[model samples]
Target: MRGNHVIAEAAIRAGCRFYFGYPITPQNEIPEYMSERLSKIEGGVFIQAESEIASIHMVIGASMAGGRVMTSSSGPGISLKQEGISFLSALELPAVIVNMSRGGPGLGNIAPSQSDYFQATRGGGHGDYRTIVLAPNSCQEAGDLTYKSFDLADKYRIPVLILGDGMLGQMMEPVELPPEIPVKRLPPKEWTITGAKGRPSRFIRSLILDPFEEEEHNWKLMRKYEKISKEELLWETFSIEDAKMIVVAFGTAARIAKGAIKRVREEGLKVGLFRPISLWPFPTKILKEISRKVKHLFVFEMNMGQMVEDVKLAVDGGAEIHFYGRPGGIIPTPLEISRIISSYYYQKKLG
Candidate 1:
């Protein structure tokens, strides 16, 4: 199945009963699959919202109604949903969002790109908040990550992002869907709005007018973020024990980098790969640990360079830092990456 369809199907198995999203390229398959399949479920609801804004708002509503809800889109459409994302953040709602990003500053090509790195890692909307951003490098991870995203969302009571590029969404590959994850595994969402029946009326709010109350709320959020950082930072490392250089990448770029690292190793270069599975609450500590053993670090990405900044901060001058990237939807090939690494190693020797 296509990766996009895998995400939709995986969401079904994860007990997501509501899907609200608008149509967008490279991700149309997700909503299409949902529209076709969700209705068959006993309580499933699928809505093809009129706009991205409407779709996100619909998700917020569904979430309040105590349903596992999700929405998907590309860069521009994601921008339209930022306000709602902020609302979800402010209310501390548990919902999942998938950004199958295409190249873009504004309505860019449908080709694969990771230009939304900042938007996903940083709070894209107004106010102080963060979303747990998960990046999947393969079709299998796309399904697995999408399935797990809902649990992370509920765990944190915050929006979680499955950050994939156009390549992952459009590509096809084999995947083994997990048996349905029983909802009993997660703690009950006692805060969700079911109704005002036989109990006190419930309120779902993001606005705190008082200065002291708002300040306290922000601190509470910060404390939760700290816990997530400590507990949820996830990444994968390859051949780091004897590596002289560490290549850092994520998502599709990481997939390509793995091949590049393998080829470079065959040429007798001591290089390894560090792929961050969680972008926000990034695997900084792991990078630091690996940096202690390597003399240099390189970051490869589909954007001009965004994750490189985080790599630098983690390395903290312990290693020489370099970046290679192709912006505007161009993917760097394995050979191209190997050649660059070769040149970099030789240049260091000469210096």
Candidate 2:
């Protein structure tokens, strides 16, 4: 199945009953698939919202009504949804958002690019809230992570983000569907403001004017983030124990890094790859431990050194960190990454 379709199917299996999205390149297949499948379900709703803002709000409203909801978009659409996302977080809503990112500071092309790293991982919306951002490198993970994103959002009572690039959304690869996992529905809509019955009405607002109240709310959200950092920092490591150099990457770049690692290994160079599955709760501790054993680190991304800053912070100047990648819609190839590894080895030998 196509990667986007895998995500759409996984959303259905995960009990997402509502999907609202605007058509965008490299990820339009998700909405297209949902439009077909959602109609078959008894109470499912799929809407091609007039705009990204409406799409995000529609999903958030559905989530507040105790329905599993989702939305997908690219870079520009994501920017438009930021306001609604911030509001959803402020209300502690549970929904999954997928950003099959393209290039840009603004209106970049529909080619695969990880340039949205900072925006996705570091709270693109206003205020001091964080989204649980998962970065999947393969089509299989694209499906699996979409399912997991719903659970994470519910677990933390916050929006979760599945961050991928065009390659992950557009590529086709074999994916094994998980066994029939039971869909966990939200608790009886007691907390939701559906309507005032015999009980008191509920309000879902993020406004707390008092500094003390706002501080309290912020601290509660922070505690959730701290727990997530401890429990959900996921990553995959390959050939790094005795490696002379390590490649730090995520999403599509990580896939290319794997090929580059293989090529350098065949050439008798001790290189390895580290791919982060969770971009928000980055695997900083693991990278720090690996840094102690490696002399050099190379960070390959689809953007200009966004994640490299985190890598450098993790290593804390213990190892040399070098970054190489293309900006905008350009993607770095395996051969180019291999050459970078070879150049690092040459420089080390000369030194």
| Steric overlap count per candidate | 0, 0
List where candidate 2 sits over 4 angstroms from the true fold.
180-190, 196-198
Measured by TM-score, the strongest candidate is: 1
Instruction: Flag clash pairs in model 1.
Output: none
238, model 2: CA deviation in Å? 0.5
lDDT of 1 by residue, 1-351 (tens): 899999999998898989999999979999999998988877789999999999999999999977889999999999999999999999999899999999989999999999999999996899999999999988899999888888889888899999998899989999999678655564577888888888899898888999999999999999999999999888998998888888899999998888888898898988888899999989988888888878788899899999999888888998889898899999888989888887887777722
Q: What is candidate 1's TM-score against the reference? A: 0.97
> Which 10-residue span in candidate 2 carries the lowest summed lDDT?
180-189
lDDT of 2 by residue, 1-351 (tens): 889999999988888889999999989999999999989987889999999999999988898888889999999999999999899888999889999999887888999999999888887889999888999999899889998887788788889999998989999999996553444543444566678889887788899999999999999999998999999898999998778888899999999999988998898888889998998898889899988888688899999789998898888998898888788888778898888888887788722
Off by over 4 Å in 1: 182-187
